[model samples]
Target: MAEQKNRFPLKRREFVKIAVSFLPAAFLLPATARAMALVRSPVRVNRLRPPGAVPEEIFAGKCIRCGRCVEVCPYRSIELLDIRAGVFAGTPIIRAEEIPCYLCMKCTQVCPTGTLQKISQEKTRMGLAVVNRHLCYTWQSMTICRTCFDVCPFKEKAITLDQLRPVIMEEYCVGCGICSHACPVTAADGMKAVTIEPIYSWE
Candidate 1:
């Protein structure tokens, strides 16, 4: 009985030491998991959700992945993400460069869940369009390229000519990605001079 009692204290000490070693990792585990989730998530630049999408944080949980948005899109702009998208798999995504969202507002109307709230095309803020002056022919004085300006749905409101170079107006730009697809100048990396960025993705 005495021998067992003596060993109990030693076992307790070993357990305490082991638990202490894991304490720091326990504190860091949640943060590490969150960081890993962000890395593996489908959210990224140029990839837009259907118009009137809710914030990305709640999007996965709220979205039932029924593909209603994909089916209702008359322009065939929305596509379901494959299994490689991690938790966001089966969720609808718009690859503007390939098939830009036409802002027909059809997808928003078909969503069974509020993940894609119905809103006006003019009010939908899917993302923002950024102009890379270095790659832009008009900005760099290479050629008079007004393709982006001409293709923009908002035209004079979203994009305007400044000294004949296309300038993006953030407040009015809807990030529809039409300009990105229409831009004639393609960088060596295959990116357009004007690209839509997921500026409003997180929130």
Candidate 2:
């Protein structure tokens, strides 16, 4: 009788262990497959766009997903979301928090299509990076350094000199990434750079 009782418990435990192991796969597989399908299918028809002022027409019409943009991005902000859907299955997606774009224009420079567009620093408008006067060392009555303005390719334009201090012109800011890359304050307090959000959707 004792042997049988112990055997019963052992059988029950074995069943429970088996059930527990397979349960997770049952739930996870469907979700993982769906996500994979969404990324792999060409004509995504549900891809979410990046946030901020990116050119929708250019992104939709030109991006070829050659990985050049992601490869050249110094900050590694651009990444391939998936290889399932959208214009380019393995195209780059901007991950602002992990590695925000610095507007270096290297991606645009390497893009084979006009997706990234080719504009001189004088006419570059890849979104502007504005200084939070409250956060800026120069505006906060601290040291004086215009690293962002000096590094900007736009000559006396995109980021201009106001009394030898950097000032952003909203109309001219195109969210490129140059100022973000050159900002000396980025490593200190996550300041000096932020990408405009909610512009695109690759659902």
Q: Give per-residue CA lDDT, model 2, range 59-120, as digits (tens).
A: 64566657777777787777775644534456566533344555566776777776666655
Candidate 1 residue 12 C-alpha distance from true site, Å: 34
lDDT of every model, 2 decimals:
0.88, 0.56
Query: What overall lDDT, based on C-alpha atoms, would model 1 receive against the true structure?
Result: 0.88
What does the lDDT come to for candidate 2? 0.56
**Which numbered prediction scores highest in lDDT against the true structure?**
1
Across residues 3-122, which tens digit of lDDT does each residue of candidate 1 receive?
998768567788899999999999899978876764465756678898899998889889999998888889899999887677888999998888898899988888999899988878
TM-scores for every candidate against the unseen true structure: 0.81, 0.49
